[model samples]
Target: SKTVSTILVTGGSSGIGKCIAIECYRQGAFITLVARNEEKLLQAKKEVEKCAINDKQVVLCISVDVSSDYSQVESVIKQAQEKLGPVDMLVNCAGTSMSGKFEEVEVDRFKKLMEVNYLGSVYPTRAVITTMKERRMGRIMFVSSQAGQIGLFGYTAYSPSKFALRGLAESLQMEIKPYNIYVTVAYPPDTDTPGLAEENKTKPLETRLISETSGVCQPEQVAKIVVRDAIVTMGLFRTIALFYLGSFDSIVRRCMIQREQSKAADKRE
Candidate 1:
Protein backbone atom coordinates (compact mmCIF):
# COMPACT_ATOMS: atom_id res chain seq x y z
CA SER A 1 0.00 0.00 0.00
CA LYS A 2 1.10 3.61 -0.68
CA THR A 3 2.28 5.49 2.43
CA VAL A 4 1.64 9.14 1.52
CA SER A 5 -0.91 10.78 3.80
CA THR A 6 -2.04 13.98 2.11
CA ILE A 7 -2.40 14.94 -1.58
CA LEU A 8 -3.40 18.16 -3.34
CA VAL A 9 -4.67 17.93 -6.91
CA THR A 10 -5.44 20.93 -9.12
CA GLY A 11 -8.33 20.26 -11.53
CA GLY A 12 -9.56 17.65 -9.06
CA SER A 13 -13.20 18.48 -9.74
CA SER A 14 -13.52 16.07 -12.63
CA GLY A 15 -12.06 13.56 -15.09
CA ILE A 16 -8.62 12.10 -14.48
CA GLY A 17 -7.99 14.40 -11.54
CA LYS A 18 -11.08 13.24 -9.69
CA CYS A 19 -10.27 9.62 -10.47
CA ILE A 20 -6.76 10.04 -9.12
CA ALA A 21 -8.20 11.49 -5.91
CA ILE A 22 -10.52 8.53 -5.67
CA GLU A 23 -7.72 6.01 -6.12
CA CYS A 24 -5.64 7.66 -3.44
CA TYR A 25 -8.57 7.95 -1.06
CA ARG A 26 -9.13 4.23 -1.39
CA GLN A 27 -5.58 3.81 -0.20
CA GLY A 28 -6.38 5.82 2.97
CA ALA A 29 -4.91 9.26 2.18
CA PHE A 30 -6.34 12.68 2.97
CA ILE A 31 -7.23 14.61 -0.21
CA THR A 32 -7.48 18.28 -1.14
CA LEU A 33 -9.58 18.82 -4.29
CA VAL A 34 -8.83 22.13 -5.99
CA ALA A 35 -10.63 23.63 -8.98
CA ARG A 36 -12.23 26.85 -10.20
CA ASN A 37 -15.83 25.62 -9.84
CA GLU A 38 -17.30 25.44 -6.38
CA GLU A 39 -20.18 23.26 -7.55
CA LYS A 40 -17.94 20.76 -9.27
CA LEU A 41 -15.50 20.71 -6.40
CA LEU A 42 -18.27 19.81 -3.98
CA GLN A 43 -19.53 17.11 -6.31
CA ALA A 44 -16.01 15.66 -6.63
CA LYS A 45 -15.47 15.82 -2.89
CA LYS A 46 -18.59 13.70 -2.38
CA GLU A 47 -17.37 11.17 -4.93
CA VAL A 48 -13.87 10.93 -3.45
CA GLU A 49 -15.26 10.65 0.07
CA LYS A 50 -17.20 7.57 -0.98
CA CYS A 51 -13.94 5.77 -1.77
CA ALA A 52 -12.25 6.22 1.58
CA ILE A 53 -11.04 3.05 3.25
CA ASN A 54 -10.76 4.65 6.69
CA ASP A 55 -13.03 7.10 8.49
CA LYS A 56 -10.06 9.20 9.53
CA GLN A 57 -9.37 10.40 5.95
CA VAL A 58 -10.63 13.89 5.14
CA VAL A 59 -11.56 15.48 1.81
CA LEU A 60 -11.16 19.24 1.44
CA CYS A 61 -12.34 21.37 -1.49
CA ILE A 62 -11.09 24.79 -2.59
CA SER A 63 -12.32 26.78 -5.59
CA VAL A 64 -9.67 28.89 -7.29
CA ASP A 65 -8.17 29.16 -10.76
CA VAL A 66 -4.67 27.72 -10.46
CA SER A 67 -3.47 29.81 -13.41
CA SER A 68 -4.94 33.18 -12.51
CA ASP A 69 -2.98 34.71 -9.60
CA TYR A 70 0.09 33.32 -7.92
CA SER A 71 -0.62 35.00 -4.60
CA GLN A 72 -4.13 33.62 -4.52
CA VAL A 73 -2.81 30.15 -5.30
CA GLU A 74 -0.17 30.47 -2.63
CA SER A 75 -2.76 31.63 -0.11
CA VAL A 76 -5.09 28.71 -0.81
CA ILE A 77 -2.23 26.20 -0.57
CA LYS A 78 -1.22 27.59 2.78
CA GLN A 79 -4.77 27.22 4.06
CA ALA A 80 -4.88 23.64 2.85
CA GLN A 81 -1.66 22.81 4.64
CA GLU A 82 -2.86 24.42 7.87
CA LYS A 83 -5.86 22.11 7.86
CA LEU A 84 -4.55 18.82 6.47
CA GLY A 85 -0.81 18.93 7.13
CA PRO A 86 1.95 19.54 4.54
CA VAL A 87 1.28 18.09 1.08
CA ASP A 88 2.72 14.61 0.63
CA MET A 89 2.00 14.80 -3.10
CA LEU A 90 1.03 17.51 -5.55
CA VAL A 91 -0.72 16.75 -8.85
CA ASN A 92 -0.76 19.50 -11.48
CA CYS A 93 -3.74 18.30 -13.48
CA ALA A 94 -5.51 21.53 -14.39
CA GLY A 95 -5.13 22.28 -18.11
CA THR A 96 -7.07 23.38 -21.19
CA SER A 97 -6.69 22.59 -24.90
CA MET A 98 -7.73 24.29 -28.14
CA SER A 99 -7.13 22.45 -31.41
CA GLY A 100 -7.10 23.92 -34.94
CA LYS A 101 -4.74 24.58 -37.83
CA PHE A 102 -2.17 27.19 -36.77
CA GLU A 103 -3.65 29.84 -39.08
CA GLU A 104 -7.28 29.07 -38.25
CA VAL A 105 -6.82 29.24 -34.48
CA GLU A 106 -7.14 32.73 -32.99
CA VAL A 107 -3.77 34.13 -31.84
CA ASP A 108 -5.26 34.90 -28.42
CA ARG A 109 -6.04 31.23 -27.81
CA PHE A 110 -2.33 30.45 -27.95
CA LYS A 111 -1.81 32.64 -24.91
CA LYS A 112 -4.86 31.25 -23.11
CA LEU A 113 -3.70 27.66 -23.57
CA MET A 114 -0.24 28.51 -22.29
CA GLU A 115 -1.67 30.35 -19.31
CA VAL A 116 -3.92 27.44 -18.40
CA ASN A 117 -1.71 24.49 -19.32
CA TYR A 118 1.75 25.73 -18.42
CA LEU A 119 1.51 28.58 -15.91
CA GLY A 120 -1.47 26.89 -14.27
CA SER A 121 0.75 24.00 -13.28
CA VAL A 122 3.67 26.24 -12.36
CA TYR A 123 1.72 28.19 -9.78
CA PRO A 124 0.56 25.25 -7.69
CA THR A 125 3.89 23.43 -7.87
CA ARG A 126 5.72 26.60 -6.83
CA ALA A 127 3.41 27.10 -3.88
CA VAL A 128 3.92 23.60 -2.48
CA ILE A 129 7.56 22.96 -3.37
CA THR A 130 9.11 25.05 -0.62
CA THR A 131 7.32 23.07 2.09
CA MET A 132 8.09 19.80 0.31
CA LYS A 133 11.80 20.58 0.23
CA GLU A 134 11.79 21.69 3.85
CA ARG A 135 10.17 18.39 4.84
CA ARG A 136 12.61 16.36 2.68
CA MET A 137 9.81 14.16 1.33
CA GLY A 138 7.22 14.67 -1.43
CA ARG A 139 6.01 13.54 -4.83
CA ILE A 140 4.91 15.73 -7.76
CA MET A 141 3.04 14.59 -10.82
CA PHE A 142 2.52 16.64 -13.99
CA VAL A 143 -0.36 15.29 -16.08
CA SER A 144 0.90 15.95 -19.57
CA SER A 145 -0.79 14.42 -22.65
CA GLN A 146 0.36 12.12 -25.45
CA ALA A 147 0.56 15.26 -27.58
CA GLY A 148 3.19 16.50 -25.14
CA GLN A 149 5.63 13.88 -26.39
CA ILE A 150 4.75 13.99 -30.12
CA GLY A 151 3.86 16.93 -32.36
CA LEU A 152 0.96 16.16 -34.66
CA PHE A 153 -0.39 17.94 -37.78
CA GLY A 154 -3.04 20.18 -36.19
CA TYR A 155 -1.78 20.66 -32.63
CA THR A 156 0.39 23.72 -33.20
CA ALA A 157 -1.04 25.52 -30.18
CA TYR A 158 -1.88 22.65 -27.85
CA SER A 159 1.21 20.48 -28.17
CA PRO A 160 3.67 23.15 -27.17
CA SER A 161 1.74 23.96 -24.00
CA LYS A 162 1.71 20.30 -22.99
CA PHE A 163 5.37 19.88 -23.96
CA ALA A 164 6.36 22.61 -21.53
CA LEU A 165 5.42 20.29 -18.62
CA ARG A 166 8.19 17.87 -19.56
CA GLY A 167 10.79 20.59 -19.22
CA LEU A 168 9.34 21.54 -15.85
CA ALA A 169 9.24 17.94 -14.63
CA GLU A 170 12.77 17.01 -15.73
CA SER A 171 14.47 20.12 -14.47
CA LEU A 172 12.58 20.15 -11.19
CA GLN A 173 13.48 16.51 -10.59
CA MET A 174 17.21 17.25 -10.92
CA GLU A 175 17.07 20.00 -8.31
CA ILE A 176 14.76 18.14 -5.89
CA LYS A 177 16.30 14.68 -6.12
CA PRO A 178 18.72 15.31 -3.28
CA TYR A 179 15.80 16.34 -1.09
CA ASN A 180 14.02 13.01 -1.86
CA ILE A 181 11.19 14.74 -3.68
CA TYR A 182 10.40 12.84 -6.88
CA VAL A 183 8.89 14.66 -9.87
CA THR A 184 7.09 12.70 -12.56
CA VAL A 185 5.71 13.78 -15.93
CA ALA A 186 2.98 11.60 -17.36
CA TYR A 187 2.11 11.54 -21.07
CA PRO A 188 -1.32 10.01 -20.67
CA PRO A 189 -3.11 8.71 -23.76
CA ASP A 190 -5.93 10.93 -25.03
CA THR A 191 -8.65 10.24 -22.46
CA ASP A 192 -12.40 10.57 -22.42
CA THR A 193 -12.80 13.75 -20.39
CA PRO A 194 -14.85 16.92 -20.46
CA GLY A 195 -11.78 18.87 -21.54
CA LEU A 196 -11.29 16.62 -24.55
CA ALA A 197 -14.96 16.94 -25.52
CA GLU A 198 -14.64 20.72 -25.58
CA GLU A 199 -11.49 20.55 -27.70
CA ASN A 200 -13.11 18.16 -30.22
CA LYS A 201 -15.63 20.83 -31.20
CA THR A 202 -12.79 22.87 -32.73
CA LYS A 203 -10.29 20.06 -33.40
CA PRO A 204 -8.97 19.89 -36.97
CA LEU A 205 -9.31 16.77 -39.12
CA GLU A 206 -5.58 16.00 -39.26
CA THR A 207 -5.17 16.26 -35.51
CA ARG A 208 -8.18 14.01 -34.94
CA LEU A 209 -6.76 11.44 -37.37
CA ILE A 210 -3.43 11.27 -35.62
CA SER A 211 -5.05 11.09 -32.19
CA GLU A 212 -7.24 8.20 -33.30
CA THR A 213 -4.15 6.13 -34.00
CA SER A 214 -3.70 5.52 -30.29
CA GLY A 215 -7.44 5.49 -29.56
CA VAL A 216 -8.93 7.26 -26.58
CA CYS A 217 -8.37 6.00 -23.01
CA GLN A 218 -10.63 6.24 -19.97
CA PRO A 219 -9.71 8.82 -17.34
CA GLU A 220 -9.85 6.19 -14.59
CA GLN A 221 -7.38 4.00 -16.43
CA VAL A 222 -5.05 6.93 -16.94
CA ALA A 223 -5.29 7.91 -13.29
CA LYS A 224 -4.42 4.39 -12.17
CA ILE A 225 -1.35 4.23 -14.39
CA VAL A 226 -0.17 7.72 -13.53
CA VAL A 227 -0.73 7.37 -9.77
CA ARG A 228 1.20 4.11 -9.82
CA ASP A 229 4.02 5.67 -11.78
CA ALA A 230 4.15 8.76 -9.61
CA ILE A 231 4.78 6.68 -6.50
CA VAL A 232 7.42 4.34 -8.00
CA THR A 233 10.09 6.74 -9.29
CA MET A 234 10.95 9.24 -11.99
CA GLY A 235 11.04 7.38 -15.30
CA LEU A 236 11.72 7.76 -19.03
CA PHE A 237 9.27 7.04 -21.86
CA ARG A 238 8.27 3.40 -21.81
CA THR A 239 8.78 1.07 -24.82
CA ILE A 240 5.07 0.82 -25.62
CA ALA A 241 4.74 4.57 -25.55
CA LEU A 242 7.50 4.79 -28.18
CA PHE A 243 5.62 2.33 -30.39
CA TYR A 244 2.54 4.52 -30.24
CA LEU A 245 4.63 7.52 -31.23
CA GLY A 246 5.80 5.60 -34.31
CA SER A 247 2.19 4.89 -35.27
CA PHE A 248 1.31 8.57 -34.92
CA ASP A 249 4.18 9.53 -37.22
CA SER A 250 2.71 7.35 -39.97
CA ILE A 251 -0.65 9.05 -39.61
CA VAL A 252 0.93 12.50 -39.96
CA ARG A 253 2.84 11.38 -43.05
CA ARG A 254 -0.33 10.02 -44.66
CA CYS A 255 -2.15 13.28 -44.02
CA MET A 256 0.71 15.24 -45.65
CA ILE A 257 0.59 13.07 -48.78
CA GLN A 258 -3.19 13.50 -49.05
CA ARG A 259 -2.91 17.27 -48.79
CA GLU A 260 -0.25 17.39 -51.56
CA GLN A 261 -2.30 15.16 -53.92
CA SER A 262 -5.42 17.28 -53.35
CA LYS A 263 -3.45 20.44 -54.18
CA ALA A 264 -2.13 18.84 -57.44
CA ALA A 265 -5.67 17.91 -58.58
CA ASP A 266 -6.93 21.45 -57.92
CA LYS A 267 -4.03 22.96 -59.92
CA ARG A 268 -4.75 20.60 -62.88
CA GLU A 269 -8.37 21.82 -62.97
Candidate 2:
Protein backbone atom coordinates (compact mmCIF):
# COMPACT_ATOMS: atom_id res chain seq x y z
CA SER A 1 0.00 0.00 0.00
CA LYS A 2 1.07 3.56 -0.67
CA THR A 3 2.01 5.62 2.36
CA VAL A 4 0.35 9.03 2.49
CA SER A 5 1.47 10.73 5.69
CA THR A 6 -0.08 14.15 5.34
CA ILE A 7 -3.40 15.03 3.71
CA LEU A 8 -5.32 18.27 3.11
CA VAL A 9 -9.04 18.03 2.39
CA THR A 10 -11.13 21.03 1.38
CA GLY A 11 -14.81 21.04 2.46
CA GLY A 12 -13.56 18.71 5.15
CA SER A 13 -16.08 19.88 7.70
CA SER A 14 -18.93 17.84 6.31
CA GLY A 15 -20.18 15.23 3.83
CA ILE A 16 -17.66 13.50 1.57
CA GLY A 17 -14.81 15.75 2.66
CA LYS A 18 -15.26 14.98 6.35
CA CYS A 19 -15.51 11.30 5.61
CA ILE A 20 -12.30 11.35 3.57
CA ALA A 21 -10.51 13.18 6.39
CA ILE A 22 -11.57 10.63 8.98
CA GLU A 23 -10.71 7.70 6.72
CA CYS A 24 -7.25 9.10 5.95
CA TYR A 25 -6.70 9.69 9.65
CA ARG A 26 -7.59 6.07 10.30
CA GLN A 27 -4.85 5.15 7.86
CA GLY A 28 -2.37 7.13 10.01
CA ALA A 29 -2.13 10.27 7.91
CA PHE A 30 -1.87 13.68 9.56
CA ILE A 31 -5.14 15.35 8.57
CA THR A 32 -5.92 19.02 7.88
CA LEU A 33 -9.57 20.03 7.46
CA VAL A 34 -10.40 23.26 5.61
CA ALA A 35 -13.88 24.72 5.13
CA ARG A 36 -15.93 27.87 5.70
CA ASN A 37 -17.73 26.80 8.84
CA GLU A 38 -15.67 27.09 11.99
CA GLU A 39 -18.03 25.05 14.13
CA LYS A 40 -18.17 22.19 11.64
CA LEU A 41 -14.44 22.27 11.03
CA LEU A 42 -13.82 21.94 14.76
CA GLN A 43 -16.32 19.14 14.97
CA ALA A 44 -14.74 17.30 12.03
CA LYS A 45 -11.32 17.74 13.59
CA LYS A 46 -12.51 16.12 16.79
CA GLU A 47 -14.06 13.22 14.88
CA VAL A 48 -10.92 12.66 12.82
CA GLU A 49 -8.76 12.75 15.93
CA LYS A 50 -10.64 9.79 17.29
CA CYS A 51 -9.39 7.74 14.35
CA ALA A 52 -5.75 8.66 14.85
CA ILE A 53 -3.45 5.72 15.30
CA ASN A 54 -1.44 7.33 18.09
CA ASP A 55 -1.32 10.44 20.20
CA LYS A 56 1.33 11.94 17.93
CA GLN A 57 -1.02 11.84 14.95
CA VAL A 58 -2.32 15.34 14.21
CA VAL A 59 -5.76 16.54 13.15
CA LEU A 60 -6.01 20.26 12.39
CA CYS A 61 -8.84 22.48 11.16
CA ILE A 62 -8.80 25.81 9.30
CA SER A 63 -11.91 27.84 8.55
CA VAL A 64 -11.79 29.61 5.21
CA ASP A 65 -14.02 30.11 2.21
CA VAL A 66 -12.19 28.24 -0.53
CA SER A 67 -14.07 30.08 -3.27
CA SER A 68 -13.73 33.60 -1.85
CA ASP A 69 -9.96 34.15 -2.34
CA TYR A 70 -7.09 32.24 -3.89
CA SER A 71 -4.39 33.94 -1.81
CA GLN A 72 -6.15 33.09 1.42
CA VAL A 73 -6.43 29.47 0.35
CA GLU A 74 -2.72 29.41 -0.46
CA SER A 75 -1.82 30.95 2.90
CA VAL A 76 -3.90 28.50 4.91
CA ILE A 77 -2.33 25.58 3.03
CA LYS A 78 1.12 26.96 3.83
CA GLN A 79 0.20 27.14 7.51
CA ALA A 80 -1.00 23.54 7.45
CA GLN A 81 2.23 22.45 5.77
CA GLU A 82 4.27 24.21 8.44
CA LYS A 83 2.44 22.33 11.17
CA LEU A 84 2.21 18.90 9.58
CA GLY A 85 4.97 18.94 6.99
CA PRO A 86 4.34 18.84 3.21
CA VAL A 87 0.96 17.45 2.23
CA ASP A 88 1.28 14.04 0.60
CA MET A 89 -2.24 14.22 -0.75
CA LEU A 90 -4.73 16.99 -1.54
CA VAL A 91 -8.42 16.16 -2.08
CA ASN A 92 -10.53 18.85 -3.76
CA CYS A 93 -13.89 18.11 -2.18
CA ALA A 94 -15.11 21.66 -1.79
CA GLY A 95 -17.98 22.15 -4.21
CA THR A 96 -21.72 22.98 -4.43
CA SER A 97 -24.58 22.16 -6.77
CA MET A 98 -27.81 23.82 -7.90
CA SER A 99 -30.70 22.09 -9.59
CA GLY A 100 -33.15 23.86 -11.89
CA LYS A 101 -33.92 24.59 -15.53
CA PHE A 102 -31.24 26.60 -17.29
CA GLU A 103 -33.47 29.62 -17.74
CA GLU A 104 -34.98 29.47 -14.25
CA VAL A 105 -31.57 29.50 -12.54
CA GLU A 106 -30.20 33.01 -12.29
CA VAL A 107 -27.06 33.89 -14.22
CA ASP A 108 -25.42 34.79 -10.90
CA ARG A 109 -26.22 31.33 -9.56
CA PHE A 110 -24.35 29.75 -12.46
CA LYS A 111 -21.38 31.97 -11.77
CA LYS A 112 -21.50 31.15 -8.07
CA LEU A 113 -21.56 27.44 -8.83
CA MET A 114 -18.54 27.79 -11.08
CA GLU A 115 -16.64 29.76 -8.46
CA VAL A 116 -17.39 27.26 -5.74
CA ASN A 117 -17.18 24.03 -7.70
CA TYR A 118 -14.40 24.71 -10.21
CA LEU A 119 -12.23 27.51 -8.83
CA GLY A 120 -12.54 26.11 -5.34
CA SER A 121 -10.63 23.05 -6.51
CA VAL A 122 -8.24 25.03 -8.64
CA TYR A 123 -7.00 27.44 -5.93
CA PRO A 124 -5.85 24.79 -3.48
CA THR A 125 -4.35 22.65 -6.23
CA ARG A 126 -2.42 25.72 -7.37
CA ALA A 127 -1.05 26.22 -3.85
CA VAL A 128 0.40 22.74 -3.27
CA ILE A 129 1.17 21.60 -6.83
CA THR A 130 4.51 23.38 -7.02
CA THR A 131 5.81 21.78 -3.84
CA MET A 132 4.63 18.40 -5.02
CA LYS A 133 6.41 19.04 -8.30
CA GLU A 134 9.60 20.03 -6.48
CA ARG A 135 9.40 16.82 -4.47
CA ARG A 136 8.31 14.90 -7.62
CA MET A 137 5.75 13.01 -5.55
CA GLY A 138 2.13 13.52 -4.47
CA ARG A 139 -1.51 12.58 -5.04
CA ILE A 140 -4.52 14.69 -6.05
CA MET A 141 -8.16 13.77 -6.31
CA PHE A 142 -11.15 15.79 -7.55
CA VAL A 143 -14.61 14.90 -6.29
CA SER A 144 -16.70 15.36 -9.38
CA SER A 145 -20.22 13.98 -9.63
CA GLN A 146 -21.67 11.33 -11.97
CA ALA A 147 -23.47 14.22 -13.65
CA GLY A 148 -20.06 15.47 -14.71
CA GLN A 149 -19.51 12.54 -17.06
CA ILE A 150 -23.05 12.60 -18.38
CA GLY A 151 -25.27 15.68 -18.41
CA LEU A 152 -28.49 15.28 -16.45
CA PHE A 153 -31.73 17.24 -16.24
CA GLY A 154 -31.80 20.11 -13.70
CA TYR A 155 -28.00 20.07 -13.44
CA THR A 156 -27.33 22.64 -16.14
CA ALA A 157 -25.47 24.96 -13.76
CA TYR A 158 -23.91 22.16 -11.75
CA SER A 159 -22.79 19.75 -14.48
CA PRO A 160 -20.71 22.19 -16.45
CA SER A 161 -18.59 23.07 -13.44
CA LYS A 162 -17.89 19.42 -12.78
CA PHE A 163 -17.14 18.81 -16.45
CA ALA A 164 -14.60 21.60 -16.20
CA LEU A 165 -12.88 19.72 -13.40
CA ARG A 166 -12.38 16.67 -15.65
CA GLY A 167 -10.77 18.94 -18.22
CA LEU A 168 -8.53 20.41 -15.52
CA ALA A 169 -7.60 16.97 -14.22
CA GLU A 170 -6.73 15.71 -17.69
CA SER A 171 -4.61 18.74 -18.55
CA LEU A 172 -2.88 18.77 -15.17
CA GLN A 173 -2.12 15.08 -15.49
CA MET A 174 -0.25 15.74 -18.72
CA GLU A 175 1.86 18.53 -17.21
CA ILE A 176 2.51 16.77 -13.87
CA LYS A 177 2.98 13.20 -15.04
CA PRO A 178 6.72 13.71 -15.54
CA TYR A 179 6.92 14.96 -11.95
CA ASN A 180 5.55 11.63 -10.65
CA ILE A 181 2.38 13.14 -9.24
CA TYR A 182 -0.82 11.10 -9.59
CA VAL A 183 -4.20 12.65 -10.45
CA THR A 184 -7.55 10.91 -10.24
CA VAL A 185 -11.11 12.17 -10.72
CA ALA A 186 -13.94 10.52 -8.83
CA TYR A 187 -17.57 10.47 -10.06
CA PRO A 188 -19.85 9.58 -7.25
CA PRO A 189 -23.62 9.30 -7.67
CA ASP A 190 -26.14 11.18 -5.58
CA THR A 191 -24.65 10.83 -2.13
CA ASP A 192 -26.38 11.23 1.20
CA THR A 193 -24.83 14.49 2.30
CA PRO A 194 -25.97 17.73 3.87
CA GLY A 195 -25.10 19.43 0.61
CA LEU A 196 -27.26 16.95 -1.27
CA ALA A 197 -30.11 17.60 1.14
CA GLU A 198 -29.92 21.31 0.41
CA GLU A 199 -29.74 20.64 -3.32
CA ASN A 200 -32.88 18.48 -3.15
CA LYS A 201 -34.82 21.38 -1.71
CA THR A 202 -34.35 23.32 -4.94
CA LYS A 203 -34.16 20.33 -7.29
CA PRO A 204 -36.70 20.28 -10.09
CA LEU A 205 -39.05 17.30 -10.32
CA GLU A 206 -37.40 16.03 -13.50
CA THR A 207 -33.97 16.43 -11.96
CA ARG A 208 -34.98 14.47 -8.88
CA LEU A 209 -36.41 11.73 -11.05
CA ILE A 210 -33.23 11.52 -13.11
CA SER A 211 -31.11 11.31 -9.98
CA GLU A 212 -33.34 8.70 -8.38
CA THR A 213 -32.57 6.27 -11.20
CA SER A 214 -29.20 5.80 -9.59
CA GLY A 215 -29.37 4.89 -5.93
CA VAL A 216 -27.57 7.04 -3.40
CA CYS A 217 -24.28 6.09 -1.79
CA GLN A 218 -22.89 6.82 1.63
CA PRO A 219 -20.14 9.42 1.96
CA GLU A 220 -17.89 6.94 3.75
CA GLN A 221 -18.15 4.42 0.93
CA VAL A 222 -17.35 7.02 -1.70
CA ALA A 223 -14.44 8.34 0.41
CA LYS A 224 -12.80 4.93 0.58
CA ILE A 225 -12.91 4.48 -3.19
CA VAL A 226 -11.53 7.97 -3.75
CA VAL A 227 -8.63 7.60 -1.32
CA ARG A 228 -7.72 4.19 -2.68
CA ASP A 229 -7.58 5.48 -6.27
CA ALA A 230 -5.60 8.58 -5.29
CA ILE A 231 -2.75 6.50 -3.81
CA VAL A 232 -2.18 4.37 -6.89
CA THR A 233 0.21 5.65 -9.54
CA MET A 234 -1.74 5.81 -12.79
CA GLY A 235 -1.87 7.47 -16.18
CA LEU A 236 -3.91 10.53 -17.09
CA PHE A 237 -7.70 10.39 -17.45
CA ARG A 238 -8.12 7.81 -14.74
CA THR A 239 -11.57 7.96 -13.13
CA ILE A 240 -12.92 6.26 -10.03
CA ALA A 241 -16.49 5.11 -10.40
CA LEU A 242 -18.44 4.81 -7.15
CA PHE A 243 -21.81 3.94 -8.67
CA TYR A 244 -23.43 2.57 -11.85
CA LEU A 245 -23.92 5.95 -13.48
CA GLY A 246 -20.39 6.91 -12.60
CA SER A 247 -19.10 4.05 -14.79
CA PHE A 248 -21.28 4.90 -17.78
CA ASP A 249 -18.69 6.99 -19.53
CA SER A 250 -15.98 4.38 -19.11
CA ILE A 251 -18.28 1.65 -20.40
CA VAL A 252 -19.15 3.64 -23.48
CA ARG A 253 -15.50 4.41 -24.15
CA ARG A 254 -14.62 0.75 -23.83
CA CYS A 255 -17.24 -0.27 -26.34
CA MET A 256 -15.95 2.26 -28.82
CA ILE A 257 -12.41 0.97 -28.46
CA GLN A 258 -13.52 -2.60 -28.93
CA ARG A 259 -15.42 -1.75 -32.06
CA GLU A 260 -12.42 0.00 -33.55
CA GLN A 261 -10.17 -2.91 -32.75
CA SER A 262 -12.56 -5.33 -34.39
CA LYS A 263 -12.66 -3.20 -37.51
CA ALA A 264 -8.88 -3.08 -37.65
CA ALA A 265 -8.60 -6.87 -37.35
CA ASP A 266 -11.14 -7.39 -40.13
CA LYS A 267 -9.19 -5.05 -42.40
CA ARG A 268 -6.02 -7.16 -41.82
CA GLU A 269 -7.91 -10.37 -42.71
User: Candidate 1, residue 159: CA error in Å?
Assistant: 0.7
Model 1 per-residue lDDT tens digits across residues 18-56: 999998888888999999999999999999988878778
Over the full model, what C-alpha lDDT does candidate 1 score relative to the true structure?
Answer: 0.87
Runs in model 2 with CA error above 4 Å?
1-4, 233-269
Global lDDT of each candidate? 0.87, 0.87
Off by over 4 Å in 1: 1-4, 235-269
Task: Measure candidate 2: CA RMSD.
Answer: 9.9
Candidate 2 to truth, TM: 0.86
RMSD of each: 15.8, 9.9
lDDT of 2 by residue, 1-269 (tens): 33548999999999999999988888888888999889888888888888878777888888898888989999999999988899889999999888999899998998899999999999999999999988989889999999999998888899999999999997687667656788889899999999999999989999888888998999999998888878754734434333653355456556756977999999999
